[model samples]
Structure formats: structure tokens, C-alpha cells
Target: MNKILVVDNNPVIRKMLSSALEKEKYQVECAEDGLSAFDCLDRFVPDIIFLDLIMPNINGEQFCQMISGRKGLEHTKIVVISGVAVEAGGECEMKGVHASIAKGPQFVSHVIDIARKFTCDHFHHAGIYQVFGAENLFPREISKELLAANRHLKVVLNNMSEGIVELAVDHRIIFANPAAAQLAGMAQEKLLASDFAQFFSGNDQIRVIDLLKQNKIMAQQITDNDPVMFNHQQVAINFLPVHDRENSTVVVIIKDISKTKIAEERLRETKEYLHSIFNSVQAGIIVIDVETNIIIDANLRALELYGIAKPDMLTHDCRDLLCPRPEERSCPVLQEGKTTHLTTQTVKKRNGQTMHILKTATVCMINNRQYIIESFLDITEQKKLENKLHSLSITDELTGLLNRRGFMMMAKKQLRIADRNPGKLFLLFADVDNLKWVNDTYGHDIGDMLLVKVAKLLASFRRSDIIARLGGDEFAVLLSDSSPTGGEEKISARFESLLYEENEKKDLGFPIEVSFGVVAYDNYKPCEIDELIVKADKLMYSSKKSKKI
Candidate 1:
């Protein structure tokens, strides 16, 4: 007989496990605690140990560790029984326990099967353990094949692309595959005895359970993008119910469609990006499909111009939705078949509100489908004060270079590219010398002109580089493909020589002197682009000190 030891502090649990194991014809032994279990081990060498984690002396984890290190008991399988979280049971496995079973009366048959699997020939005469009286339901010869099939089915279920879970009719989990456990953020053994409602939040639990009771597959989109918070993370769940005619068990497959949700989000962002650009222009933008000549997409300005209250009604064919025109009124842009930057007259708005609107349309393809992009700039209020103010915020009033905010935005983009390529990036800090002398001698207007001239010179040098004026007499440049030893120094020296030449040629009451310093990126060390600027600033101050000396 294959000797099996059942250890638990609870007498009822120990007796139930012993009865289950004896029914499978295994030689069963019982112990109330770990010390008694060790004594049982000394007398009878058991093939498998069923250990209860919470016991009086030397709990299951410690006992398993001790027994696993024994010289001849290396092959003896240790199965841990626990009412705690399954992660604790997994810790026991890492310490050399072979399997873990949840402690419950309903889990008795499962524990027996686990024992029989490890114990070789001891339980062959006894019939396989079955729950819900499934033994007499199938023929004896087919029973073995059915058990084998179920084993294979479990392997397939565990490896499935989608998550699979089986629940008793009352909603207690009976089986859960690894993917299902991972999706639910729980362990399989712990989930087996848990209620399905426990996995969902308050309102979600009620919503999901009600849906499951209807026995219909249900899908809903979740929109939380944060990975840490459950509600903040988005996922689409599809629930399917499984029925076993003989056992009356219901299995539900839960699939996590986070990828699909991400795709939908990207699509929405693209639409919003297009809308932002469209609203920024004084023109109204409209998109139409070429194949069906249907109005597929339009911006808010376009809807306002057309005087349409419901935009969805315009999604139909353009000819059916718009006012009828002669056959000769075909768009000239389409006739050209190339990018047409010409102005054309059109009666696009409602009949009563018809006006001479400048329309431009171009053909483009998105996602392998063809469409026409039409833009209509009203240009009615060209001299608006608010529009000019918006432009001034992004543009420098003195030097016409991008303002500090705009420069910061563009520099962030270049930094991202540098991070991806893992290459040398250089930041140059420049400060104009004798700026106070210029203001004292030549007046503030000439000082401003000198700054503007320097900005123009720097802008003409490298259009690709990001240039920004950090307040009066201070300017910064970001250079790509430059390093400390050769490429960076060469560029820095070229700029220095250019500044010296300009200063030597022009004399506007004060010298046009500038000090500069450069810092190259260290690929091995990860640092923010602003850190490079700080280093460059310190080096520039060092250069200014040397010039004074």
C-alpha cells in the first residue's frame, strides 16, 4: 500500500481527508500536528504528505522544508493544505512542496486525486475519485479514457489564448486556469474555493453576477489606463457560460481585451488630434470618402459653417446631403489629381446663408482606404486681436525665435529621439558679454537689435537645432550627432569663431562679445536633458572667468 500521512490541527478536516484517501484504497495515517507527523514519518515511510499550513508546532512550511532535505525522502511528494492566500502556499512549493490544496470539505476528492497521482501502484484497484457522483454516469472502460481526456482538456484550458474558469452552479469557483488567475489578479488554488463576486468591485460585482445569471455572453469596455489602480486600468471582458449536462456545472470563460481597448483609445486620440488642428485653423475642415462620395468626418467649424444641428446626418453621401449642383461643378482639386493649393468658389453652406467660401481639397488614404480632405478658411476676421495674441505667445517678440515654452516643447521631442537612438547629444549655453555696457552706452533699442541679430545668426546656422533665448542676453542651442571629443568641439569652435568675426567687424559703441560652453551626452549614464543644460551653464561660467583673467 502507498502510505499517505494527513496532518491538520482540525480533527474534522483530518478525518475527512483520511476517509477520502481510504476510499481510494491508500494506506492512510493521521497526525494532529507537525511533531506527531514527524513521529508518523519515523514509523511508517509515507509516499505522500498532506500538510496543513496552520498547526500547533512547526507548521507546514517548516515541516516541508525539513522533510524535503531528508536523505532518502527526496522523492516523497509533499502537498500543502492551507486556508491562507495561495501565494503563501506557493512559497511552500518554492521550499520543495510538490502541490497545494485549499482546506475545505468540498476539496476532499481533489486532495485524494492529487495523492493518488504521486503514489504509484497503491490506488490502481480503487476507482478514480469523482465529485458530483460522476462515476456511474460513464462506463468503467471509458472512465479511464474520460479521466485522461479531462487531464488533456485541463492542459489545453491552461494554455488557452483566452482565460477559462469553471464555477459551481452556486457561483463558487471549482476550476481556474493560470491565465484566468492572472487576469483576475489572484492565485488559482485560492480562487478555487472563492466566490466569483469577490474578484469584482461593489457595483461591478452586481453587474457581472446579474449578467452571468442570464447565461448570455456579455461584453463591456473598461477605460481606466493606469496599471496600478484596478478601476483606472481599462479592459473589455467577454463572458461565456459552459454547461455539463451530467454534473450540472457552469463554466465561464473570461477574456481580457486590453489590447482592443488600447486600439480604440488610439483611434479616439487620432480623431481628437485631427479635431484640434482643424479648430486651430481659421478654416473649416471636412473629410469625405472617395469611393462612396460620402462625408465620413468633419470638424466643429465645418458643422457650424454648414448650419447643421446634427452632424451625423451629414455622414450620408455628399450629393444626397448637400444642395444639388450642375454636373460641371465637379471639384477642380480632384480633376488636377495632384496637391491643389488653389482657391475655388463654392456654394457649400445652406441656400439662405450662401457665401463665397474658399475651399481646398486634397486626396489622401488612411488605413488603406481613400478619402478627400477639404479645408475652408472663412478668413472673415483676419485682423482679430485674440488670434494675434495667441501667435505672440508661441513666438519671441524680440528675436522671432520660438518662446521659452515652445522651445521647451520642441526640446522634449528631440530628447525622446536621442533616448531611442542612444547617441551623442550636445547642449550649448551662450551668454553675451558687455550686455550691461551696451544698454548703458547705446540705449535699450540698440541692445534689443544686437540680441535680434545674434538670434538671426544662430537661426540661420542650424534650422534643425532647437534655439531658445532664456531671457535677456542668454541663449541655448541643442545639437544632435555631436560628442565631446571631436564632433561637439568642432561645432562649438565654429560657432565661437563666427561670434568673434561678427564682433570684430561691427562696433556699435560696445563690443559684441559672447561666451559659450558645451556638454556631450554620456550614453552609459541616463540623465535628463535639463541636467546637460546645467552642466553647460557651469562650464560657460568657467569660460567667462578665464576671459576675465
Candidate 2:
């Protein structure tokens, strides 16, 4: 019979528990106080302890802590019976108590059943045959055959990689394989009829009971508070529910998932470390669901850029987030099926401030779910520098207009647009008269100032016009939606008046004279933009010669 120790300050309660356990054929010892219980532990090493709180000398929580810290009493299970709430009992359980029972006047049988269930043996061991007279009945040959069969069965059960155990409906253990025994840190024979709760710590027993009652197969990693001894070694355990068809009994599989648990702990630590790094990163990061296009995760930089306290507020699409104007189609990231990179796209921040951002996106899978990782680098300053470099490359510094190369590029694009539309295109080619005379009479600085003034005067025309400094003392303008008869006359009159006003002011330090030739492409289609430019150039030379004569 298994021995039990019942400790309680209330003499009546102590007597009742002792009598009930004794009736169940268990050797029961009674202790009226925590001090007495501690004294009892030296001589009578009971298998289980029924502990009570609110005792003299030491409180239940303190006693449990002391007992749990002791090495010699490691296998002795302690069940707390207290007047406190279940939560308080759970706290005590965390201190390494095996289970807890509510203090009440009734339910003595239930308590005894709980205590006896942990002590019974449900399996027939090898020594049972000799003790029960089964060794003399069978012939030697039949006995050898039976022994061989039993050995093979035990070998098969022991070799199974998964921990397997069978329990009776009354919550008594019926059988336990070697794996199950190792997981629970008890011999298979000892665990055969033991109470299943003996294998679980206090709070976990409640959860285990709930899972078994529901008959649901649950898979989860659990951390043990009171560690169990397995093969003379302490180990963490993972309990997995196994489906059984025969006898409709519960078959639980246990595994020593200490390594898996360690890996998960490391993963959690790594995740927290990365989260810290992400928040401190300079670049903004946003993680979105590929299918729903919802922002699932965002770093601190992204939240700051969006000016939102939480990620849930931003409801606009990706295009709205990045584009200066509303696009007729979605952004390339959404339109393209694969990862993409975009440069020099204008994005509006939450404050309605517009800036340039260089963005890249990649598709990644996490926990079997697909997500898009979008990274944004602020490029407003970079873009400003790039624009400055481009201007230096393609613009005449003195004239403040497109140089020859820039003019050619703009003219080509304008001609393409003009060919597709029904609008008229006009080209004005002009040359400053007597530039060498101005340079020789006045200083070169004055001549340079005259060129600048001429470029400004041309730019003062309609914004729709494209003005360029073709070369030194030469300028070109491309006007769209203008006619040959009406547009040419209007442009000539405006040019004459502007030149007269400028010469009257003498801002150029000399009489500013310019020769101009205007040509209109009004249904007079040319094969290419360069062809039209050549025609206009020839007409300008003719006008210059005429003016000189």
C-alpha cells in the first residue's frame, strides 16, 4: 500500500482525511501543524503529502517552497488543500506542488479517490504470475512460448519512438510503454495503475482534465513548473493526444521536447532582438499581406513617416501612398507578379508634404503565409542633388536655358506628341545680330549679359513654349497649338515690340538687334523632329542674310 501524509491545523479535518485514506488501504500519517509535518518527513518518507495552509510555525506557501527546495523529497508529491481561491492554489502549485484541493466539509470520497488513484497498479507485472500460482499450471514448452511472446510484445512497446500510455476511464493508468515511463520519470510497472494527475503539476492537471473530457486532440508546447525526473535525469515533457479506436480509451503520447522548447526560447529571443533593431533602423519598413494588401507590420520609421499612432489607420492603396498624382492603374508592385524596384517616385507624407522615395519590395513567406516586404529609403535630398547635376550637364549656365543636347531631346518628345494630336507646331529660330561687334566694342561680360537678357526675354513668352539656348548668341523656341498665318504674325509683332523696348532701355549696353525666322507645321508633316529643325535652321540663316543686306 502507498503511504500518505495528511497535514492540517483543524483536528477534525485531519482525522477525516486520514480515515478516508486509511479506508482506501493506504498507510495514513497525520500532522496537526507545519512543524509536525516537517518533523514527520525525516522518519516516514510518504509517497504523497496532503498539505494544508494557515498552520502554525510556517504558512503553506512557505512550507511548500522549503519542501520543493529539498533534494531528498523530490519524488514525494505534495497536494495543497486550502481555503484560498483556485488562483492562490495555482501560485502554490507553481512552487512545485503536485496538485491542490479546495478545503470543504464534503467530498471526502473524491479526495480519497484522488489520493488512491495515484497509488494503484493497473498492469500485471512479471512477478505477479509466480505470486498468483500461474507458474505451475502451464507446461514448460507453453511457458517458453508465452515468455517469448511477452518478450516480443515488451520489445515492440519499448522500441516505439512515440511515448504511449493507456488510461482507464476512471483516470487510473492501465499501461505505460518505456517511452511514457521515461517521459513521466517512473518505472512502467509503477505507472501502470497510478493516477494520471501524478504525472502533471498542479495547474496542468486542470488543463489535462479539460482536454481529456473534451476528447479533443490538442497539440501545443507546454513549459513545466515542477520538473520531472526521467531515467534518473530531469527533463521537460510534451504531452500529445493520440487517437485510439480500440476500447475507446485515452492514449496519451509523451515526448521529451526539451530541445524543441529550447529552440523556441531562442527563436523568441531572436525575434525580440530583431524587433529592437528594426525600430532603430534608418530605413522605413512595411510588411503587407500579399492577397489582402493590408499592412500587417510596420517599423518605427514607417509609422513616423505615415504620422499614425497605430498601423490600422492608413487605409489608402499603395499608389496613393507613393504617387504625386492619381494613377489610372495600380502601382507596379501590385501590377507585377514578382518583386520590383522603383526609383525617383514622389510620395506624400501624412502631413501633405511631398518627397521623393526610392523603394524596393520582395515577396517572402512566413509561417506558410505569403507577405511582401517593402523598404523605403528617403531620397528627397539625393533627388535635389541629382537634379542639380542633370542641369549642369544639359543646360547653358550663362543663358539659363537648355543647351543643344537638352533642346534636341525636348524637341523630339514634343514632335512625337504633336504627331499624335491635331494641334499645330511652330518653331522660331533666332540669332543675335553683331555679337562680335558687341564683344569687341563693349566687354565680353556685357556681351554675355546681353545673351542672358535675350534668353530671359524668350522665356517671358507663354509657358507652353519650349525655349532653348541652341548655342552662343542663338536661341530656339517650339510652340504648340499655333497656326502659320495667325501665330507667325502674332509672334513677329511681339518680338519686334520686345526688342524695341529692350534697346530703348539699353539694358544690353548696345542696341540689341536679333534676326528671327518662324516656321509652322500646320499639317505639313515632317518625317522626324531633326528634319523640321534643319528646315527652320536654313530659314533663320536666310532671314539673317536678308537683315544684313
Candidate 3:
């Protein structure tokens, strides 16, 4: 099995890498830092080293330097894992490392590729070793096998797209491919036997001649984006040592990356500009994965609106801030399968205060992943203002009773219930006995007080009864279901007693008196609410006329 070593200061990261590699059936080892890793290397030489750039006792650069001149560790390739950007640079070359991969969503995949590349390289060499078995093969057969392998390698090296050149210990170009000669702006035969350092300048900060002076067996990479070469092309180069125990030679691979480098620079600039605009907008913005609802990105305004710290908001489920039922609440943005959706919701904050928010979510895709771009604004104050206006429109401010419009709306709902079930329904229409006379004698304030008192009296009945101030000196009530024993008569008797007691006290500016007319109906005998009101009005006038007699 291929051995893989993970060196990171974080235990979680170390365990995560180890578990993933182990699951792949590779022998994996974990170390806290460079010191622990050094101890690991003494016993077991891994095919690949997963090294973190930043660690406690010794950092990645120091560890690379220490391991570079080591005799037995020559074939081990260092795959750097760093929190910072690991774009193409000369740093990897100086450290003589194979590749640098930044910590990101795709880091594990990069590690797998590195492991596969080196494993295959070693596998090829092992195949050759087995073919020329020391115990079984004759000397003549071994020499023939070696020559055949050399001829095959020569053909493959010449066909490669990347420029390849073999350099001697004195930094002389001993061999050059057609691609290397073209990069150097020279003929392949002319490029041979020339100093390799002649093609590069000091502005790049890397000198192959100086690097070769170390005479280390490990391969080193040297990359330069400076447009100082032939036709001003950027270059990425790697010098790997190949030797036969006593004599050493270096193989260099070069690739031109001018176009790719330029494209990435422009892309980065565009991203930064877009990020500035994202945060500057007034609304709170959040981008979350569609399936998981895991918050991927959140802006400054989002932080302020939710009263949350940045770190907590990024990982928390988007629904936890609004709909408490997380899994039950699928992405509202995608509910109707629309690309965009507008909605309003009430969300509770860390402070336990609820806020009404107007939200707009647009379905978006980034790097082949589905996401919802949600933008919202707190509308709590606006909602409060709307509720106040609605209340004034449907409620009597003086007595806090439902106004005519409010009563009609509610009466319809109650009527529907009464019509659906086998229940007795009663409508009571009442008029203040002499409200106009009281207003004329003692002013309208006392008249208002009497209206309020009458409203309370009407409200004191069954809780299911609906009370409303229909208009001036007019009130109505809808009673559902019959009382088991004491019916409306019981309610009327108590109201009379309360009125007489109030009249006796003389606390009000005028004595309390009200005239009532009742109309009854059952589900079997259905009638329109308007017809019931007209019948009750006629009964009230008849009662009033009888009193006059």
C-alpha cells in the first residue's frame, strides 16, 4: 500500500485527512507539526507528504529546507496545503516541492491527483526493476532491457508538449527537446551544450546555476511570469534530479502560462469589484446553498439586521433565523419552481424581538453549484403603521367596538359556521334610548360615555357573541348556539339589573337605558343577514311604540 503522511497543527484537519486517505485503502499517518513529522520520517518514508504551510514549532518552509538535503527522502514529493493563496510562484521552486494547493473546497481532490501522479511514476520504475531480476536475469538480457527502456523514454520525452531539457552538474544543457529550443528561440542542436542560465535574467529572483550548487537529489520547481523571455512569454519550470548513485543530472520541464496568468488576474479584479458592490447595497444579502440551506456568504447589512456575529451567521441554517421548522421548510425561493420569488416573513432575533421582513430571493448558480441569493429589508415599522390604519378603518375609537365594516366581515365568517352546523343563532339590535337628548342636555362627552357604557354591557354576554357599533346610537350582536338553561332572557335580566344599579348611583351624566329587538334563526330556517337586521329593526320600533302607549 502507498504510504501518505499528513502534517498539520490542527487535530481535526489531521484526522479528516487521515480518515479520507485510510478509507481509500492507503496507509496514512498524522503529525501535529514539523517536529512530529520529522520523527515519522525517520522510521517510514512515505511516497507523499501532505504538509501545511503554517504550523507551531516549525513552518512548512523550514521543514522543506531541512528535508531537502536528506539522502533517503529523495523521492518523496511535498504537496503543500496552505490557508493563503498558493498561485504560481518561485516559492515552491526555492523549497524544491512538487506542488502547492491552497485550502479550499477542492483541496482533497488535488491531494489525490498528487498521490496518483507520484504513485504511477514509482510504479513504472518498479516494473523495470522487476523485469531485470538480479537472481533470474542474465547480464546480457539486463543490458538489452535497459537499452529498450531508454529508447522508449526518449521517444516519450520528445513527444511531450512541455519543454524538457537535461542539465549537467555544471549547469550545462546536455540535452534539449524541440519545445525547449523553441522557448529559448534557438535550434535544438544549438541549445545543447549551452549554459541553461543564459536564457533567464536576474529580475526573476531565481538562478538555476545557484540552485544546482546545492547538489540536492530532490526535484525543485522554478516559475517566472516576468515577460523577459523570447516573445515575452511567462514560464513555469521544474528541475528534477536523476542520477545513478555517483553521478547526478537534472531534468527540467517548462510550460508557458502567459494567457492563463493574465486571465486569472482579470478574474480576481472583477470578483473584488463585485464584492464591494455587494456589501455597499442597503439591503441585507445572503447566499446559501439551495439543498443544504447552509449560509455560504453574508454581507455587513445581514449581520446588522440579524444581530449576529459574522462567524455564527455563515454556518447557521438560514431557516433558523426565520422559520423554526428547518427541514420542513424547503427553499421558499424555489417553492413554485420560479427563478425569482418575493415574500414577507416574521423572524426572531437573538434579542428575542420579532422583525417583519420583505425578502426577495433569486435562484443563482456559482461554479456549477445551485444557490439562492436572498436580499431582505426589515419592515417591522411599516407593518405596525399598516396595522394602525386598518384598526382605525374598522374599529370605533371611542368604545373600542368593531365598526360597521369590521362587524360585517366577522359576521360573514360566523354566519358560515352557523349555516354549516345545526345551531340556533340570534341577532340582537339595540338603540340607546335617548342618546340625542342626553347629548343636547349634557354635551356630547357624556353622550360618548353612555355609548361606551352600553358597549361594555353588550360585550358582557357569551364570549362567542359578536358586538359592534353599527352607527350613531346603533349597536348589533350575533349570538351563536343556545344557552343550556338561562337563554338571552338571563342576559337581558342581568343587563337590566346592571343599568338600574348604574342609574341609582347617578355616576353617569345620564341614566343608562337601551331598547332591544331580537330575531332568531336555526340552520333549518336559513335567511340572509340583511333580512334578519331589517326584521329586528321593525321589532325595536314596535317595542318603542308600545312604550309610548
Top model number, TM-score:
3
- Mark the regions of model 1 whose C-alpha exceeds 4 Å error after superposition: 1-148, 208-247, 276-280, 306-331, 344-354, 379-549
Model 3: residues >4 Å from true position, as ranges? 1-160, 165-178, 181-203, 206-209, 216-218, 223-234, 241-250, 266-390, 433-447, 484-488, 504-508, 542-549
Q: For candidate 1, lDDT tens digit of each residue in 48-148?
A: 88888766534565466446566668667677777642323234454666666654445687687777566654443444322221222323445345546
Model 1 global lDDT (CA atoms, 0 to 1): 0.68
Per-candidate clashes come to 2, 2, 1
Error of 2 at 444 (Å): 2.6
Cα lDDT of model 2 by residue, 321-432, tens digit: 5444556545466567765655456777778887778777877888998777888888888988999999888798888798988888888888878877777788888888
Off by over 4 Å in 2: 1-261, 280-282, 310-336, 339-346, 385-388, 417-424, 480-490, 525-539, 542-549
lDDT of each: 0.68, 0.69, 0.75
Give residue 217's error in model 1 in angstroms: 15
Cα lDDT tens digits, model 3, 98-196, are 666666666676676557767778533532211101122223555446546755886897788888887766676666777887888886656655677
State the weakest 10-residue window (summed lDDT) of model 3: 128-137
